[model samples]
Target: MESHTSVVLSLYRHGVTRENQEKIYIGWTDVPVAEEGIDLLMKTKANRPEAERVISSDLKRCVQSADYLFPEEKKIYHKGLREIHFGDWEGKKADELSKRKDFATWLEDPENMRPENGESFEEFSTRIQESWEMIREWCFQDGVKKIAIVSHGGPIRQLLTLLAPAEKPFWEWKPLHGQGITLYWQDAEAFRRGERCTSLSAVPIMEKENG
Candidate 1:
Protein backbone atom coordinates (compact mmCIF):
# COMPACT_ATOMS: atom_id res chain seq x y z
CA MET A 1 0.00 0.00 0.00
CA GLU A 2 2.99 2.25 -0.06
CA SER A 3 2.33 5.35 -2.16
CA HIS A 4 4.70 6.43 -4.91
CA THR A 5 4.55 9.63 -6.90
CA SER A 6 5.18 10.11 -10.59
CA VAL A 7 3.61 11.54 -13.73
CA VAL A 8 3.79 10.57 -17.37
CA LEU A 9 3.43 13.33 -19.97
CA SER A 10 3.48 12.11 -23.53
CA LEU A 11 3.87 14.48 -26.51
CA TYR A 12 2.73 13.48 -29.94
CA ARG A 13 4.69 13.84 -33.20
CA HIS A 14 5.50 17.42 -34.19
CA GLY A 15 7.31 19.49 -36.81
CA VAL A 16 6.05 18.16 -40.08
CA THR A 17 8.73 17.12 -42.55
CA ARG A 18 8.44 17.93 -46.24
CA GLU A 19 7.02 14.48 -46.76
CA ASN A 20 4.59 15.01 -43.96
CA GLN A 21 3.58 18.38 -45.32
CA GLU A 22 3.01 16.66 -48.60
CA LYS A 23 0.68 14.25 -46.85
CA ILE A 24 3.05 11.32 -47.15
CA TYR A 25 3.65 8.62 -44.59
CA ILE A 26 7.15 9.40 -43.41
CA GLY A 27 7.35 6.66 -40.83
CA TRP A 28 10.71 6.17 -39.15
CA THR A 29 12.52 8.55 -41.49
CA ASP A 30 14.50 10.42 -38.80
CA VAL A 31 13.31 13.73 -40.24
CA PRO A 32 14.00 17.02 -38.48
CA VAL A 33 11.32 19.34 -37.19
CA ALA A 34 10.04 22.18 -39.35
CA GLU A 35 10.38 25.81 -38.20
CA GLU A 36 6.77 25.81 -37.08
CA GLY A 37 7.56 22.73 -35.04
CA ILE A 38 10.08 24.68 -32.97
CA ASP A 39 7.46 27.35 -32.44
CA LEU A 40 4.95 24.78 -31.30
CA LEU A 41 7.32 23.30 -28.71
CA MET A 42 8.23 26.77 -27.44
CA LYS A 43 4.58 27.60 -27.06
CA THR A 44 3.84 24.34 -25.29
CA LYS A 45 6.58 24.86 -22.71
CA ALA A 46 5.55 28.45 -22.19
CA ASN A 47 2.11 27.17 -21.28
CA ARG A 48 2.97 23.99 -19.32
CA PRO A 49 5.33 24.40 -16.41
CA GLU A 50 5.16 20.67 -15.61
CA ALA A 51 7.14 19.99 -18.78
CA GLU A 52 10.45 21.09 -17.25
CA ARG A 53 12.21 17.80 -17.72
CA VAL A 54 12.14 16.25 -21.18
CA ILE A 55 12.94 12.77 -22.45
CA SER A 56 12.92 12.54 -26.23
CA SER A 57 13.65 10.09 -29.00
CA ASP A 58 17.14 10.26 -30.53
CA LEU A 59 15.58 11.08 -33.92
CA LYS A 60 16.24 14.51 -35.34
CA ARG A 61 12.69 15.90 -35.10
CA CYS A 62 12.23 14.69 -31.56
CA VAL A 63 15.69 15.90 -30.55
CA GLN A 64 15.06 19.26 -32.17
CA SER A 65 11.75 19.62 -30.36
CA ALA A 66 13.39 18.71 -27.04
CA ASP A 67 16.30 21.10 -27.54
CA TYR A 68 13.94 23.94 -28.35
CA LEU A 69 11.65 23.28 -25.40
CA PHE A 70 14.17 22.43 -22.65
CA PRO A 71 17.58 23.63 -21.64
CA GLU A 72 20.34 21.42 -23.09
CA GLU A 73 21.43 20.12 -19.67
CA LYS A 74 17.91 18.98 -18.73
CA LYS A 75 17.18 16.81 -21.76
CA ILE A 76 17.66 13.07 -22.04
CA TYR A 77 17.68 11.13 -25.30
CA HIS A 78 16.31 7.57 -25.34
CA LYS A 79 16.52 5.35 -28.39
CA GLY A 80 14.00 2.86 -27.03
CA LEU A 81 11.38 5.59 -27.43
CA ARG A 82 11.96 6.04 -31.16
CA GLU A 83 9.21 5.65 -33.78
CA ILE A 84 8.11 2.28 -35.13
CA HIS A 85 10.33 1.42 -38.08
CA PHE A 86 8.11 1.20 -41.18
CA GLY A 87 10.66 -0.74 -43.31
CA ASP A 88 10.12 -0.47 -47.08
CA TRP A 89 7.17 1.89 -46.70
CA GLU A 90 9.10 4.54 -44.79
CA GLY A 91 8.27 7.42 -47.11
CA LYS A 92 5.29 6.19 -49.05
CA LYS A 93 2.06 8.09 -49.50
CA ALA A 94 -0.58 6.82 -47.12
CA ASP A 95 -3.34 7.10 -49.69
CA GLU A 96 -1.42 5.06 -52.20
CA LEU A 97 -0.45 2.43 -49.66
CA SER A 98 -3.96 2.21 -48.29
CA LYS A 99 -5.06 0.66 -51.57
CA ARG A 100 -2.84 -2.38 -51.06
CA LYS A 101 -4.41 -5.51 -49.56
CA ASP A 102 -1.68 -5.84 -46.93
CA PHE A 103 -2.08 -2.20 -45.98
CA ALA A 104 -5.82 -2.73 -45.61
CA THR A 105 -5.15 -5.64 -43.30
CA TRP A 106 -2.70 -3.57 -41.33
CA LEU A 107 -5.25 -0.84 -40.84
CA GLU A 108 -7.84 -3.38 -39.80
CA ASP A 109 -5.71 -5.28 -37.27
CA PRO A 110 -2.31 -3.72 -36.84
CA GLU A 111 -1.33 -6.22 -34.19
CA ASN A 112 -1.04 -8.96 -36.79
CA MET A 113 0.35 -6.96 -39.67
CA ARG A 114 3.99 -6.17 -40.30
CA PRO A 115 4.94 -3.70 -43.00
CA GLU A 116 7.27 -5.08 -45.63
CA ASN A 117 10.75 -5.14 -44.08
CA GLY A 118 9.52 -3.37 -40.92
CA GLU A 119 9.27 -4.49 -37.34
CA SER A 120 5.98 -6.04 -36.35
CA PHE A 121 3.49 -4.14 -34.23
CA GLU A 122 4.20 -6.57 -31.40
CA GLU A 123 7.87 -5.71 -31.51
CA PHE A 124 7.16 -2.00 -31.44
CA SER A 125 4.72 -2.44 -28.56
CA THR A 126 7.25 -4.40 -26.52
CA ARG A 127 9.93 -1.74 -26.95
CA ILE A 128 7.53 1.01 -25.94
CA GLN A 129 6.41 -0.93 -22.88
CA GLU A 130 10.02 -1.38 -21.88
CA SER A 131 10.67 2.33 -22.31
CA TRP A 132 7.70 3.11 -20.10
CA GLU A 133 9.03 0.81 -17.41
CA MET A 134 12.41 2.49 -17.50
CA ILE A 135 10.80 5.92 -17.24
CA ARG A 136 8.64 4.78 -14.34
CA GLU A 137 11.69 3.46 -12.51
CA TRP A 138 13.65 6.66 -13.11
CA CYS A 139 10.76 8.81 -11.90
CA PHE A 140 10.35 6.79 -8.71
CA GLN A 141 14.08 6.83 -7.98
CA ASP A 142 14.38 10.54 -8.56
CA GLY A 143 11.08 11.46 -6.88
CA VAL A 144 10.01 13.13 -10.07
CA LYS A 145 6.41 14.27 -9.94
CA LYS A 146 6.26 15.40 -13.56
CA ILE A 147 8.15 14.82 -16.78
CA ALA A 148 7.73 15.32 -20.53
CA ILE A 149 8.44 12.88 -23.32
CA VAL A 150 8.71 13.77 -27.01
CA SER A 151 8.14 10.80 -29.28
CA HIS A 152 6.51 9.66 -32.50
CA GLY A 153 2.77 9.17 -33.06
CA GLY A 154 2.94 5.39 -33.43
CA PRO A 155 4.48 4.81 -29.99
CA ILE A 156 2.30 7.43 -28.40
CA ARG A 157 -0.82 5.81 -29.83
CA GLN A 158 0.39 2.39 -28.68
CA LEU A 159 0.92 3.67 -25.15
CA LEU A 160 -2.44 5.39 -24.97
CA THR A 161 -4.26 2.37 -26.38
CA LEU A 162 -2.58 0.30 -23.66
CA LEU A 163 -3.14 2.79 -20.84
CA ALA A 164 -6.66 3.99 -21.63
CA PRO A 165 -8.74 1.52 -23.52
CA ALA A 166 -11.52 3.22 -25.41
CA GLU A 167 -15.07 2.60 -24.39
CA LYS A 168 -16.38 3.92 -27.67
CA PRO A 169 -14.94 3.30 -31.14
CA PHE A 170 -11.38 1.97 -31.42
CA TRP A 171 -10.29 4.87 -33.62
CA GLU A 172 -10.86 7.23 -30.70
CA TRP A 173 -7.70 5.86 -29.12
CA LYS A 174 -5.38 7.61 -31.57
CA PRO A 175 -3.19 10.48 -30.31
CA LEU A 176 -3.22 13.75 -32.21
CA HIS A 177 -0.27 15.85 -33.30
CA GLY A 178 1.36 18.08 -30.65
CA GLN A 179 -1.22 16.76 -28.21
CA GLY A 180 -0.32 15.23 -24.84
CA ILE A 181 -1.79 12.98 -22.19
CA THR A 182 -1.12 13.50 -18.47
CA LEU A 183 -0.98 10.45 -16.24
CA TYR A 184 -0.46 10.35 -12.50
CA TRP A 185 0.80 7.33 -10.58
CA GLN A 186 -0.09 7.65 -6.89
CA ASP A 187 2.12 4.88 -5.49
CA ALA A 188 4.34 2.00 -6.44
CA GLU A 189 1.51 -0.51 -6.34
CA ALA A 190 -0.85 1.72 -8.26
CA PHE A 191 1.93 2.42 -10.69
CA ARG A 192 2.44 -1.30 -11.15
CA ARG A 193 -1.31 -1.72 -11.48
CA GLY A 194 -1.45 0.93 -14.19
CA GLU A 195 -3.81 3.09 -12.14
CA ARG A 196 -3.98 6.76 -12.96
CA CYS A 197 -5.04 9.66 -10.75
CA THR A 198 -7.20 11.11 -13.52
CA SER A 199 -7.17 11.77 -17.21
CA LEU A 200 -6.88 15.35 -18.34
CA SER A 201 -8.57 16.97 -21.31
CA ALA A 202 -6.85 16.75 -24.67
CA VAL A 203 -4.13 19.28 -25.37
CA PRO A 204 -5.60 22.22 -27.28
CA ILE A 205 -5.40 21.43 -30.96
CA MET A 206 -3.56 23.84 -33.16
CA GLU A 207 -5.27 24.62 -36.43
CA LYS A 208 -4.22 22.35 -39.26
CA GLU A 209 -3.67 25.39 -41.44
CA ASN A 210 -1.13 26.74 -38.93
CA GLY A 211 0.60 23.40 -38.67
Candidate 2:
Protein backbone atom coordinates (compact mmCIF):
# COMPACT_ATOMS: atom_id res chain seq x y z
CA MET A 1 0.00 0.00 0.00
CA GLU A 2 1.26 3.46 -0.82
CA SER A 3 1.48 5.66 2.22
CA HIS A 4 1.07 9.40 2.06
CA THR A 5 -0.30 12.00 4.44
CA SER A 6 -1.95 13.78 1.54
CA VAL A 7 -4.32 10.95 0.64
CA VAL A 8 -7.97 11.76 1.30
CA LEU A 9 -11.21 9.92 0.52
CA SER A 10 -14.64 11.46 0.17
CA LEU A 11 -17.39 8.98 0.90
CA TYR A 12 -20.95 9.71 -0.17
CA ARG A 13 -24.28 7.91 0.21
CA HIS A 14 -26.56 7.35 -2.79
CA GLY A 15 -29.38 9.83 -3.17
CA VAL A 16 -33.00 9.39 -2.11
CA THR A 17 -34.66 6.22 -3.35
CA ARG A 18 -38.28 5.09 -3.74
CA GLU A 19 -37.79 3.04 -0.60
CA ASN A 20 -36.51 6.10 1.19
CA GLN A 21 -39.54 8.05 0.11
CA GLU A 22 -41.78 5.14 1.07
CA LYS A 23 -40.03 4.54 4.40
CA ILE A 24 -39.03 1.00 3.47
CA TYR A 25 -35.79 -0.90 3.96
CA ILE A 26 -34.13 -1.23 0.51
CA GLY A 27 -31.27 -3.52 1.23
CA TRP A 28 -29.53 -4.51 -2.02
CA THR A 29 -32.53 -4.19 -4.30
CA ASP A 30 -30.82 -2.38 -7.23
CA VAL A 31 -33.18 0.53 -6.84
CA PRO A 32 -32.77 3.80 -8.72
CA VAL A 33 -32.61 7.21 -7.14
CA ALA A 34 -35.40 9.70 -7.44
CA GLU A 35 -35.05 12.82 -9.59
CA GLU A 36 -34.21 14.72 -6.43
CA GLY A 37 -31.31 12.33 -5.89
CA ILE A 38 -29.77 13.01 -9.28
CA ASP A 39 -29.72 16.70 -8.50
CA LEU A 40 -28.07 16.08 -5.17
CA LEU A 41 -25.26 14.13 -6.81
CA MET A 42 -24.51 16.89 -9.31
CA LYS A 43 -24.32 19.34 -6.45
CA THR A 44 -21.99 17.00 -4.55
CA LYS A 45 -19.65 16.81 -7.52
CA ALA A 46 -19.66 20.57 -7.92
CA ASN A 47 -18.83 20.92 -4.25
CA ARG A 48 -15.80 18.67 -4.60
CA PRO A 49 -14.38 19.63 -7.96
CA GLU A 50 -10.89 18.70 -6.82
CA ALA A 51 -11.59 14.97 -6.65
CA GLU A 52 -9.57 13.01 -9.21
CA ARG A 53 -11.31 9.65 -9.13
CA VAL A 54 -14.91 8.57 -8.67
CA ILE A 55 -16.01 5.14 -7.51
CA SER A 56 -19.38 3.62 -6.64
CA SER A 57 -21.24 0.44 -5.85
CA ASP A 58 -22.38 -1.67 -8.78
CA LEU A 59 -26.01 -1.27 -7.68
CA LYS A 60 -28.32 0.85 -9.81
CA ARG A 61 -28.88 3.72 -7.39
CA CYS A 62 -25.19 4.23 -6.74
CA VAL A 63 -24.26 3.85 -10.38
CA GLN A 64 -26.90 6.37 -11.32
CA SER A 65 -25.63 8.79 -8.72
CA ALA A 66 -22.05 8.42 -9.92
CA ASP A 67 -23.07 8.74 -13.52
CA TYR A 68 -24.88 11.96 -12.86
CA LEU A 69 -21.86 13.37 -11.08
CA PHE A 70 -19.18 12.10 -13.47
CA PRO A 71 -20.98 11.28 -16.66
CA GLU A 72 -18.08 11.59 -19.05
CA GLU A 73 -15.91 8.91 -17.52
CA LYS A 74 -16.37 5.33 -16.41
CA LYS A 75 -16.49 4.89 -12.66
CA ILE A 76 -14.89 2.11 -10.68
CA TYR A 77 -17.66 -0.29 -9.78
CA HIS A 78 -16.98 -2.62 -6.85
CA LYS A 79 -19.56 -5.14 -5.69
CA GLY A 80 -18.04 -5.09 -2.22
CA LEU A 81 -19.37 -1.56 -1.86
CA ARG A 82 -22.99 -2.69 -2.25
CA GLU A 83 -25.62 -2.33 0.46
CA ILE A 84 -26.31 -4.84 3.21
CA HIS A 85 -28.42 -7.76 2.05
CA PHE A 86 -31.65 -7.71 4.06
CA GLY A 87 -32.44 -11.24 2.85
CA ASP A 88 -36.21 -11.80 3.32
CA TRP A 89 -36.72 -8.32 4.75
CA GLU A 90 -35.26 -6.61 1.70
CA GLY A 91 -38.16 -4.25 1.15
CA LYS A 92 -40.01 -4.30 4.47
CA LYS A 93 -40.77 -1.38 6.70
CA ALA A 94 -38.73 -0.86 9.86
CA ASP A 95 -41.77 -0.42 12.05
CA GLU A 96 -43.23 -3.66 10.78
CA LEU A 97 -40.00 -5.51 11.48
CA SER A 98 -39.71 -3.93 14.91
CA LYS A 99 -43.07 -5.40 15.82
CA ARG A 100 -41.59 -8.85 15.59
CA LYS A 101 -40.20 -10.45 18.75
CA ASP A 102 -36.75 -11.00 17.23
CA PHE A 103 -36.42 -7.44 15.94
CA ALA A 104 -35.14 -5.79 19.10
CA THR A 105 -32.65 -8.55 19.74
CA TRP A 106 -31.42 -8.40 16.18
CA LEU A 107 -30.94 -4.64 16.32
CA GLU A 108 -29.24 -4.73 19.70
CA ASP A 109 -26.55 -7.15 18.57
CA PRO A 110 -26.38 -6.83 14.83
CA GLU A 111 -22.83 -8.05 14.73
CA ASN A 112 -24.03 -11.60 15.26
CA MET A 113 -27.71 -11.51 14.39
CA ARG A 114 -28.97 -12.45 10.97
CA PRO A 115 -32.37 -11.55 9.61
CA GLU A 116 -34.51 -14.47 8.38
CA ASN A 117 -33.02 -14.32 4.90
CA GLY A 118 -30.67 -11.33 5.27
CA GLU A 119 -26.98 -10.99 5.83
CA SER A 120 -25.45 -10.72 9.30
CA PHE A 121 -23.58 -7.59 10.32
CA GLU A 122 -20.34 -9.48 10.20
CA GLU A 123 -20.92 -10.48 6.58
CA PHE A 124 -21.64 -6.90 5.58
CA SER A 125 -18.63 -5.57 7.43
CA THR A 126 -16.31 -8.11 5.84
CA ARG A 127 -17.49 -7.12 2.35
CA ILE A 128 -16.78 -3.46 2.96
CA GLN A 129 -13.42 -4.29 4.46
CA GLU A 130 -12.47 -6.02 1.27
CA SER A 131 -13.50 -2.93 -0.67
CA TRP A 132 -11.36 -0.79 1.61
CA GLU A 133 -8.37 -2.94 0.80
CA MET A 134 -9.04 -2.50 -2.89
CA ILE A 135 -9.41 1.24 -2.42
CA ARG A 136 -6.03 1.44 -0.75
CA GLU A 137 -4.43 -0.45 -3.58
CA TRP A 138 -6.00 1.80 -6.21
CA CYS A 139 -4.96 4.94 -4.40
CA PHE A 140 -1.42 3.69 -4.11
CA GLN A 141 -1.09 2.68 -7.72
CA ASP A 142 -2.56 5.85 -9.12
CA GLY A 143 -0.81 8.10 -6.63
CA VAL A 144 -4.19 9.62 -6.06
CA LYS A 145 -4.24 12.22 -3.34
CA LYS A 146 -7.98 12.74 -3.32
CA ILE A 147 -10.89 10.64 -4.54
CA ALA A 148 -14.67 10.47 -4.17
CA ILE A 149 -16.71 7.31 -3.64
CA VAL A 150 -20.48 7.04 -4.06
CA SER A 151 -22.08 4.07 -2.28
CA HIS A 152 -24.95 2.99 -0.06
CA GLY A 153 -25.32 3.82 3.62
CA GLY A 154 -24.43 0.35 4.85
CA PRO A 155 -21.00 0.32 3.26
CA ILE A 156 -20.30 3.84 4.41
CA ARG A 157 -21.16 2.88 7.99
CA GLN A 158 -19.00 -0.21 7.77
CA LEU A 159 -16.09 1.85 6.38
CA LEU A 160 -16.38 4.19 9.35
CA THR A 161 -15.86 1.24 11.69
CA LEU A 162 -12.65 0.42 9.84
CA LEU A 163 -11.46 4.05 9.85
CA ALA A 164 -12.64 5.25 13.23
CA PRO A 165 -13.67 2.41 15.48
CA ALA A 166 -13.89 4.39 18.70
CA GLU A 167 -15.59 7.73 19.14
CA LYS A 168 -19.24 7.73 18.17
CA PRO A 169 -22.10 5.27 18.33
CA PHE A 170 -22.89 3.38 15.12
CA TRP A 171 -26.23 5.15 14.81
CA GLU A 172 -24.47 8.49 14.99
CA TRP A 173 -22.01 7.65 12.21
CA LYS A 174 -24.54 6.54 9.62
CA PRO A 175 -24.30 8.65 6.44
CA LEU A 176 -27.48 10.30 5.24
CA HIS A 177 -28.42 10.59 1.58
CA GLY A 178 -26.14 12.96 -0.39
CA GLN A 179 -24.04 13.46 2.75
CA GLY A 180 -20.31 12.82 2.76
CA ILE A 181 -17.59 11.91 5.25
CA THR A 182 -13.97 12.78 4.56
CA LEU A 183 -11.18 10.48 5.74
CA TYR A 184 -7.40 10.67 5.68
CA TRP A 185 -5.10 7.72 5.23
CA GLN A 186 -1.42 8.31 5.93
CA ASP A 187 1.44 5.97 5.12
CA ALA A 188 -1.05 3.31 3.99
CA GLU A 189 -1.79 2.37 7.63
CA ALA A 190 -2.84 5.33 9.74
CA PHE A 191 -6.46 6.29 9.21
CA ARG A 192 -8.44 9.11 10.78
CA ARG A 193 -11.63 11.04 10.31
CA GLY A 194 -11.60 14.37 8.57
CA GLU A 195 -14.25 17.05 8.36
CA ARG A 196 -17.69 15.72 7.40
CA CYS A 197 -19.86 17.91 5.18
CA THR A 198 -23.57 17.66 4.40
CA SER A 199 -24.62 19.35 1.17
CA LEU A 200 -27.41 17.04 0.05
CA SER A 201 -30.29 19.15 1.29
CA ALA A 202 -28.59 22.44 0.52
CA VAL A 203 -27.86 21.76 -3.15
CA PRO A 204 -30.38 21.91 -5.95
CA ILE A 205 -30.83 18.87 -8.16
CA MET A 206 -29.86 19.19 -11.79
CA GLU A 207 -32.44 17.89 -14.24
CA LYS A 208 -30.79 15.51 -16.66
CA GLU A 209 -31.95 12.40 -18.47
CA ASN A 210 -30.87 9.16 -16.82
CA GLY A 211 -27.76 7.49 -18.23
What's the lDDT for all of these models? 0.68, 0.72
TM-score of 2: 0.80
Instruction: Kindly list the per-residue Cα lDDT of model 1 for residues 66-146, writing each as its tens digit.
Output: 666565438888999888888887888888887789888988887789998998988988999889888866765665656
Mind giving the per-residue lDDT tens digits that candidate 2 earns over 1-211? 3444556677888889878988787888878899877667776666544467888898998888887767776688888888888887778898888887766788887777888888888888877887787776667667677777889887887767556525555556768796576765444434322322212222233345577
For model 2, the superposed segments whose C-alpha errors exceed 4 Å read: 1-5, 185-211
Q: What TM-score do all the candidates reach, one by one?
A: 0.80, 0.80
Name the Cα RMSD for model 2: 5.2
